[model samples]
Target: MTQQTKGKASALFPLLIFILLFIGTGVLTKDFSNMPLNVAVIIAAAVAIFMNRKVKLAKKIEIFTKGAGHENIMLMCIIFVLAGAFSEVAKGMGAVDATVNLGLSLLPANLLMVGLFLIGCFISITMGTSMGTVVALTPIGIGIADQTDIPMALAMATVIGGAMFGDNLSMISDTTIASARTQNTSMSDKFKTNFFIVLPGALITALILWFITSGSHINQLEDYSYNLVKVIPYLAVLIVAILGVNVVIVLIGGIILAGAIGIIDGSYTGTTLLQAASQGVLNMEDIAIVALFIGGIIGIIQYNGGIDYLLHVVSNKIKSKKGAEFGIAGLVSVADISTANNTISIIMTGPLAKDIASKYNVDPRKSASILDIFAACWQGIVPYGGQMLAVAGLASISPISIMPYSFYPVLLGICGITAILFGFPRRKVKQ
Candidate 1:
């Protein structure tokens, strides 16, 4: 038991230091961005390597390289690229305006809150990215908030909560792919477990959002009559994504569809199309660069056996099914906090998670679902999370202020934990 405690502390030391530096700096300056999150994550990762006394520096570098270059990160990067290109190309061609207008027209003033929440969920689910979902939807959410006189925090949080729902649950989502692949569970099975757990939380949150915004009223406006042809691309993207088409192909097809429409409508010149694509890709520059660094750093950690050290220590602590579930949660949470990437956390902790599941006879699907869902619940509420950062940038608000409004993530975690305690998603035990 002492050894188990020691392992947890040793594993957590880097994270403790990171929070001290990262959050400490921000609190002292009252500026979250004062200490760059990327730089801080790198520094913390180095410290993590140093803690591994058993591993050599050169070997550590190799592990970090392997983890960073893991096939999963590459796949997420591909999604990021496609999302960037599509959003850019579509925006350049006035698709956003037309789409937003069409949505506004369909959603009555009384249902604005519900409308925004649903839209946020739909877009994130389709986009497989919470940040991209936010960027695409926020300006419009904000406009509606202002025009409707709804509380900004509540409105912003509504969208954020919905976005996280998809980020955590979407089959093509990076977090889902990471956790499922990591735990050696079937993606379809994980989805079943995940959906069952999160469905109630989403329903409850939606009702709450509805209640919260029910008192507010807005003047209804006429729906913008845009060409039905212009709506085809976005609509098609949605339909194909929901049908389980490959995400990369979905994005590429969406881009092509949008571009063709743009050229046909004279909304985009050939030069504009190329320029928008370039510019759109450029928007993801920070994460793209940071992802490369993070991959390399984790590769070193892996090479040094730091990750194996965690596996040894954490796996030893499991004495029961409940303990195993908590351990899975702990593993992913630590990796998520360390990596500052929920999907990466799932990837990093996957092997260990699988081992723990096997030892405890805990359901693999449940294990994977728990890891992804909890990581997202934490990630969504974190001030430093990418979703918060992007939303804060677009909404011009502090992350602290937005935290209270993220009702969906908060409730999702609550309900998810409850699900575990009650064995809520009791699957037929696979003999």
Candidate 2:
């Protein structure tokens, strides 16, 4: 027990070092874009290795490598690569334009803001990736802003909020998969809990958008021909994913489908298709590197006792089930803030959340929901996070500029905290 406690306490140092290095440099520079997260993570990994006095240097290196190569970490890397590939290929084939035009054709002028949000939600849910949704829809949202009276930041925020909605609830979402798998819960069970918890928030966001953007005039898609065939890949991915297909398979299928459609449509030849796919994978380099470094760092910390120490410190004040649930929410929120990736945060905190839930008899389903929701909430709003960064790049606006308009995450955070404080969705009893 003494040894275990020591390990946990020791693990925290590396994590703290990472946070300080990453967040500190960003704050000091006043430019998050200048501070590379991957570098911070690598330095933290080095600190983790140096702090491990029990093992030889070679052994420590092996441990670090093992952690980075863990099955879960590798799976996430694969997903990122495939998701990037699929998104890029689809973009190359003008799928984003097609989707944007299709959505424009269906909505009334006054409801453009709300329509953008809803479409983002649908695309994110269908794509099972918030970044992908942002990549695909941010341009469309910007176009809407240019065409209508809506502000650029407001339009982009709508896309972000909607993307987060799907990221929070989509079955194939990385956060969902991480949460359910880590908590030993079923996706459907967690979805039932998560869906209802966020439904009110989603509805409120839509209503607010409608009221705010009511005066905006809609712009017709003049001479914009949308090919419906271009949308089949997203639809296929969503359909098979909903039917319980493996996420990797779903993404791979989507990539192939999009590539085939692109080729047949004369959008690209075989060589250009490969180039697009390769570029897509390259786009994910930062995240992929961070994931690997984090895996290695976390592995060493776990080996030395970081997670156990964290669990001890986090749970020390919890007495009731509600407190335990709240602790879980706080755990993932902090993790999300530190990492700036909702899916990665979920993966990191999930095991500890499960432990807390089991000890306090908190429902696993609720735990999973809380994990995904809070992570998504924090990730959606963090200016440095991938979602916000991607949108910022596409919209040519500061990520923080979109914060006030990020109604979904704000509402999500409110609803989530309220649920924990008030103990909504009372724990179910096993028959």
Off by over 4 Å in 2: 1-10, 108-113, 116-196, 208-223, 331-406, 426-431
Model 2 local distance difference test score: 0.78
Per residue, candidate 2 scores C-alpha lDDT tens digits across 1-431 of 11214235656787888777766776788775565666777888889888867789888888899988987677767766776787788879987677666666777667888888887888788768776676556656766676667889898889889989999999888888999999898898989889878999999999999998878775654755678998777667656765656768877888899899999989999999999999988877667676788778777877776665555566566777899899889878866765566887788778878888988888889899999999999988876566775566555566656877989999998889887877777757543
Query: Model 1 over residues 1-431: C-alpha lDDT tens digits?
Result: 21222223455565566677768887899886677766776787788667677768777666666766767566655655666677778877877666656666676656887877887788787667776566556656666666566877777788788888899888788888888887777888898899889988888887887787777766455445655676677778767766666667877898898898899889888998989888867765555555555566555544444455665666667788888888888777766655557876787677777877887788988999989988888888876566665555445565666887888888888877887789879988766
Q: What is the lDDT of residue 236 in candidate 1?
A: 82
What overall lDDT goes with each candidate model?
Answer: 0.73, 0.78
**Candidate that would win on lDDT:** 2
Best by TM-score: 1
